[model samples]
Target: MKLVTLAIICVLMLNSCKNKSQEEPQNQVKVEKIEYASFGKEIVASDAIAAKSMASHYKTMKTGDSIDSKMVAKVNNVCQAKGCWMRLDLDDGNEVMVKFKDYGFFVPKDITGKEVIINGKAFVKEVSVDEQRHYAEDAGKSAEEIAKIIEPKRTYSFEADGVLVVQ
Candidate 1:
């Protein structure tokens, strides 16, 4: 009788341990894989506004005024020289010039026409003629086209802390 009782207790303990082990994985949180190529800082592709909405927000902003935002847009152009900057289409005729924060990161130069999510500060600024010409040069524009950027232009700009190029 004593041997049977000991055997029964051991089996019960083993069963309980097995049950606990089986329940652990079910209680664990699931982690989702990121599908974007990240740059600068790691950022998830969540809560980003559409390009059209982002354009509207830019329209309401003035020079020197900025707002923290996350937006998704199509890459219209990128700096051909070294991928230092990019232009994103706002679903409108206007494009927003995006530069990485602190010049810390650069997106792939061949990523034009790809969708990207950017997290940063959006602001309106008057870009000087010299700067415009410089950018035109970096874009590999013709000499005449660079010369045409003779006027200071007010434009939408973003300083991105993080960027994710959709793969």
Candidate 2:
């Protein structure tokens, strides 16, 4: 009986190790505070700065394209289901979904409407069928309900390598 107990303990320990190894990798993005240059220069709001930058970079971009740059935008909403994404409200009223490059970053739920800047790549693409289903599941929608929803014509996704939570 003692030998059997020891074997069971060893098995459980091994299983725990395996599960840890299978866990998703951490987000590698870094964050830093923005610096103000001088007192006389107009200190641009974070949303304003991000808007200008995104305009310059994404103006000529089309669907199915991608670009890497620093962007600023206001956090319109965040994912309440998984906290994996934040919806950005661009100055134009167009919204973009933003996600950390990995699972490493986090933002406070109350930060909605706050401006932020992040270094990352913006992807314009259509959601694949499988991807749509996966997202639906993550958003806590039932599979049957998700299947009945219409897919988007296109989507703008941002993958951030680093983020700055600006005021």
Off by over 4 Å in 1: 1-34
In TM-score terms, which candidate is top?
Answer: 1
lDDT of 2 by residue, 25-138 (tens): 554466786652221112343433456457545556787789766677778776666567777876775777788776676656556777777666887767776776666675
Which 10 consecutive residues of model 1 have the lowest summed lDDT?
32-41
Candidate 1 lDDT tens digits, 19-107: 99999999999997858999998888899999999999989888999999999999999999889999999998999999999999999
Cα error, candidate 2, residue 162 (Å): 1.4
Which stretches of model 2 miss by more than 4 angstroms?
1-49, 52-56, 128-148
TM-score of each: 0.79, 0.56
Using lDDT as the measure, the top candidate is 1
